[model samples]
Target: MAREGRQWSDFEIAVSDYLTTLREKAGEPSYRRLAELTGIKFSRLRDIFTKQNGTPTLQEFIDLCLTFGKDPADVIYKIMKDLEAKGISLSNIPAQNDPADEANAALASADNGVDIDAWADRIKAEDSVHEEQP
Candidate 1:
């Protein structure tokens, strides 16, 4: 049973939730197996899951995401959405660039044989249209 009046940090809750989902999706692999696959210590992973004084480093988080074949950005977006649904303000978090800026940067660096500037322009136009919707 959880303690009453215990306030969980956003990072703690988000990471716990994300780990639970991953475990469920993976059919609940053994902690040892997960540690081997993700290059994280089993003891550390166990501590984090049990909220026993373990916080994952960014590299560890990224490694776990890759092990689960998930995009880190998608995970971050989901966590942000969950926080918003709970009426939790994320003002303490550093501001990120608008999604449009990220899209444009990705397009500019993509080596997929498409014209970077043209793709960026198309993305900007699409974003403008989306903003005008509803």
Candidate 2:
């Protein structure tokens, strides 16, 4: 079961439902209040939970999960399992083939089997790149 198109995972659906429940419990306050509680910025919290632009950062996701009294790992695993059930591979995530992967490949190809120093340098470079991105 491998699907090509994007679809919400069971975890996503469940989280959405859980968010809705929390909203009701909190009397459906504005996203601003939700952000205040979840520690994500107002716009970012809205974007992930309401606007559906993209997934939230791990910290935001975990915070939101905790707000709903859900275990962060459990929720993440559920979402991943749900995605797999829908034919979506975890490898489909855009970061799967990031430059880190290339560096890992390079290390794997080292004549000495893997230059640790080179790998560390490559990882540092990638981290810098990540930091420089908006």
Looking at candidate 2, the ten consecutive residues that score lowest on lDDT are 2-11
Candidate 2 residue-wise lDDT at 9: 54
Instruction: Summarize candidate 1's per-residue lDDT along 1-134 as a digit string, tens digits.
Output: 74443455786578777877888898988889989998889987786666666466678778878888899888888888788888888887866679999897886687678776787999999999999999
Clashes, model 2: 0
- What candidate 2 gets wrong by more than 4 Å, as runs, is 1-27, 51-54, 92-134
List residue ranges in candidate 1 displaced over 4 A. Answer: 1-8, 95-134
Candidate 1 global TM-score: 0.63
Q: How close is each model in CA RMSD to the real structure?
A: 14.3, 13.4
Candidate 2 residue-wise lDDT, 1-134, digit = tens: 75433455545555666566666786777888877777778887766655365655667767877877779787666666667777766674443357888997786787576667898999999999999999
Worst 10 residues of 1 by lDDT: 2-11
Candidate 1: residue 45 Cα off by (Å): 0.9
lDDT of each: 0.79, 0.69
Residue pairs in collision within model 2: none
